[model samples]
Target: MPARPHSPCVEAAPNGSFFHPDVKEAFMNAVTTEIPALAHDAGVPPAPPEAHRTADELRDIPLKRLVASPYNVRRVPPTGIKELALNIWKVGLLQNLIVHPMKVGARKAQTFGAAAGERRRLALIYLFEHDYIPADHPVRCRVVPVEDAVLLSATENEMREPMHPADACDAYRILVEAGRSIEEIADLYGVHPKTVQRRLKLARVSPKLVDLFRTGEVKLDQMQALALSDSHDEQEAAWFDAEPYNRDAHAIRRRFVRDEQSFVSNRVAKFVGVEAFEAAGGAVRRDLFSAAEDAWYRDHALMLRLATEQLEALGASVLAEGWAWVKAMPERDHATRSQFRPVLPRRTEPTDEVAKELAAIDQRLAEIAAQWEADDMDDEVAERLELEEGALSMRQDEIEGSLLVYHPDDMAQAGALLSLDANGEPVIERGLVAREPVAAATTESGENGDDDDDDSSDGRPARVAAPAVKPTKGPHSERLMLRLNAHRTAAVAAALAQQPHVAHAALVHRLLAGEYGHSTEASALDVTFRDHSHNLTKHAPELDDDLAFTMRREQRRVWGGVIPNDSDALLRWLIEQTDERLLLILAQYVAASVDSVRPDERPHAINALIPALGLNLADAWQPTKAGYFDHVSKDRIVDVVSAAVSPSDAMRVAKLKKGDAATEAERLIAGRGWLPEHFAKAEVVRMKLWDVPAKASDAEASADEAEADEPALAVSADDVRDDAAVAEGEGMPPRD
Candidate 1:
């Protein structure tokens, strides 16, 4: 073959006689394409040459001879390099670095520059500096051609995804299960010990919840809440019981453990003291991941027992003080022990020296107050003065306390009551005399005609006959009154449902109450309705377990579920809703805030308004054992039965036990449209629309005008009917 001249694609430089022209193109054209076909015909395809070296090749390269490439895609921070160094020292290099032979000047020694793993090279340098590894120690690396090293580095750094959190947790768990310490695992992975522990904790969560987390059904924070409990049953139950919107971390935590545990910060718990309760074998659950104060004590029964025992022990001294009797109670309420009259403690004059000290304290307090008023004091001076004032006040209190003592005679006749104060401290109410004995003495005096004497040497007050007047109607039993009010409230709700204009006016009344009234005294009619029903839950020990509260809570939950979650969506839905549906919602709100009783100032107003609204109390209310009949006295139960059915039926149950009588009364009045005096229509001065307060009327008038001007949209009338029925406890569907 004859030699050919160079192609024009590669031209000669101006100064040079000759230069390579189109060398690459010439080379490609010169090579024959039949090589692969010839190999295939021979029943074997030619093997492609390797583009890059594998990790196995060039494994033994000296650390001193390896230098970091200037064009590395990833850079390791200085602190990260130190941590990486420690990890490499502990576990050795697990991944091989990619490197290529570096082209150096004549003065420099031959060395390999890292292409893909600059962090590993830096870590090796750090090890050498720390004397953990020799400068010339050999490291494992995969060597590639210099021209291809940058591509390999970019691919290695960018192509791979970080490990998924669940997978990482599982891996940590596997290591922990294989007898590796948390510290050891942390060091190997270049993370904190807490990080490793958290991952391991996450791995131990209920398997089903873990699956949910992996599938994105549950979030990481929710998973953390589920991990709070080791019991899979509680975890699974919380997940299932929580509504979709209520599946937040806090809600999950509350649902998981609130019922089973009581916080140490509770009044009863503080009174009992966590130390003493724990001493008595009551277990406390503490969250290691949370703050120290965030702990709960389990076994409420045991805690209560410990508290009662402690209270009794403390009350022993009071009982020994010649008291007629000593009563110990968990809380101090006026109603519980109001029948006993408390004897005032006799105040004795302080000793001359003590009196002088008190006078000096008073003088010092006066001086400080005068100085504070006269001078523009700095904060430090003011703080010092405050401390001095507090100290003097405490001293005065101590002196006053020491001077007061109970008389022996009074202590003999009166009793002591021990109770926990609001701050959970033991308070002794001393010298309380029985009202029954006082009343008996008065009765005996009347019988003996000694009540006429205004002056008696015995120090007892003379009794006088009360002025005669026409007898007023006796009050109904509390249960009966509550049942009556419930009926009235239902009637009010139904009446409001039929009239949207009145409903709108009532809503305006609530809005004005909230806007003009104090925040603490704001009307309860703002959201739903406010009724006396919640009062029944206030004193109940098991508030969450109460039938009424539970039922009401579930109803609220259903209401919440149907409401739009997004604010804009809710606005749109409200805008599109019909007047009847809106009225039905507003009626529920208005009916809840009704307070039509004698003591309330606006009772006559509500009474007059009820008739105008056509509220049918009998049709809206029915008494049930749980809601009413069971809580009444046996005589009251008999009275209710007598009023509803017959006197014979009342007499039939009068001889039975209270529970049995109540049950009978409930059955007798099951479907009867019986209502108490409070719910019945009464004669009262009619209230005009102008009777509303001037300020309130103006606000309401504006609101009414606005509502009237707004156009109403179409809504399902069936929906309004369903809501009214639900509110009145009539034909509501069973909750899921």
Candidate 2:
């Protein structure tokens, strides 16, 4: 076929250099049949010029090396050093560092350092810090005279790739400090004069951010933007957070210095169809001082113009109407959040009745689906084959009408033949063949025609014979399985519903209620809880006497606990208790129980329970419980706390319990000679209900009796029945 391929061989080139198969192959294919000397020439980019340092003289250098150089110039920057470090880590360093000689009292001595690859130098330093290499290992470095140091450093930094912006800035700083003009630095670095100037501007940035820029944490644009801030403090603060700093480096020097913005206006302005500088200026003007009426007017006019143009383009009548409404709105007026345009045409809310009916329909559909699945295989097969309800019903009608068309025998034969074909290759007829008609016999003759002896001897229709049925083959129909799964779900649900506890929970009634509940409430009220424990003993009936006693005692408590017809002291005690213990209990219940209810139900439930819990305290107390104060009093409950308290002390409570609301008379008078006196009198009318007692105790008997004793004891109803009943007696009226 083809000449056998030669076995591969490897050898050094004839030039006695690096050995490689590709090089050898290329050598064989050369124009003159000689390995080209230029093969390696086009190979690797020159390994950077050998670093001229003493470290280079060492035969075995540590994997990572760091040495200071006398030739170091801050103007030179790291270039391919980061890449060189990565390469050395992966392939091992093949080159040495460069250093320059220093004179100590005229005796020349070499000091080790890196000439090029500042990034590599840092990376090696990182390795040393990270303990990647042994601390004491010596490294190879190349040495040169002190005069060649600057050249070496510059060549090392500049020979490969490019310097980062911060590095470039560093280099420029070195040159400037050395008496080189910005122009001269620009020419040497192959940068524009402005570039050099901009770098110098970067050099003025705070040291923290300058270092961040050096490490590339902050981009050049971000640094430029930070520099543009009008105040150094502001720029430093913004830079500390790495706020969205962006500035056009190419921006005019005057504008860059004057701008205070952190974002590059031009970049975003381009998206909105304007120059960024102008956009930024406009934004600052609009945002900074639109408070004065004149400023507001000017800004409003510009906004109106732009808005008007936008609306005109929409051209829809609805939009125009909306715009008209917006324009007609008053300026600076605050409206309650509830006031809003209607979202839809007003219609009476849906009645609960209709929702119940829809839910019932859903349940019925679930029931029907379940019934179909529980159907027999024959029915299931018919279903799988998609035997429609109407079709199946019609077939049954046809079967009852007469057994002329299909007989059990014919189906059995067809099934057997189908089975034979499935198991092995049954020779099916190549051409269609008509089956012979059965004799003058009963329907049974059509099926299993081989069973001739079972037929009537007279060959007439036999009343006793019926066609044989075939067994269902293969997997059951999917329709049947689906119906079965549905039935199973329903059966389980029904069984769960029928459980004893389900009955105790009135589950069926609840389920029915839920049918109505979902439509009315939009959620089912019935809930199923998994049982983790069972009742150990059957519930026992209480003895009649015990039961009666229990009911009577509960009744007595309920009535006794009612807000008692009491003297003013008793009423005050009750009110205070409601503000404290009763209120807290009610609150805990509301927080736990009421909150568990649906959102719509919660408001209604709370409203119904509010009066029952005696929480209709004057609006003054609402702030104490729901707003800011844990405890508030008449005058002390001002918008701001009027005084501080030590834990062990009791202070006079201020009478202005109604918080910031100025008293009605005081608000009306505004200023009057009698105002302070009237305010003092009003404070006296507000009481400290918290001082009232809840129940009698040895320490609280007088308070409790004063609070809970009947007002009837203080007044004779016959003496002044009508007026006495009007006010609970404390020299006023008898309690109801």
Give the per-residue lDDT of model 2 (tens digit) for 1-736: 9976644433433432223446444534533222123223323121223332332233433433345443344434556544444455555656656554322233533224454444556666655666665654555555443334445555565566876767767778888999999877655544568777767777777778788887877676667656644456765666553223222232212232232322222211212222332443443322111122111111333333433343333334422322222221111111311122211111122346644644555465455557667646476555554534445445433332332222333322321110011111211111112244545533323323443343224442221222222323322233322222222222222222223232232333334333221111111112333110111000101111122222322222232223333578556866777344454333222221121111111111122222223222221111222122322233333322222222111121232224222222223222222211111121101111112323457657776545433221111112222432643543311112
Deviation from truth (RMSD, Å), model 1? 22.8
Per-candidate TM-scores read 0.43, 0.22
Candidate 2, poorest ten consecutive residues by summed lDDT: 532-541
Report the poorest 10 consecutive residues by lDDT, candidate 1.
685-694
The TM-score measured for candidate 2 stands at: 0.22
Query: Backbone clashes per model, in order?
Result: 3, 32
lDDT, candidates in the order shown: 0.61, 0.35
Residues 1-736, candidate 1: write the lDDT tens digits.
Answer: 9877767644643322122335433433443243224324544322123322332256788899987564454555435888888888887898998886665556877677777788888998999998999988988888765444545566687788987678889999998889999998987878889888778878888888888888899898888777777788888888986567657786666655554544544666778876777788887764545554455766878866776788889899879878888888765444556566556665666789998998999899889979889566899989998999999999887787677676788878888888765456787777788766434323311434543554223443222222222324434454445444444544454465456677676566556433322221122243445343343233322232334334443333233334465789888988898776666665554654554422221122344445456565566556666556666667778888888899988887786657556656777798788865545534332111111212458778787555433322222222333433544763322322
**Alpha-carbon error at 55 in model 1, in Å?**
13
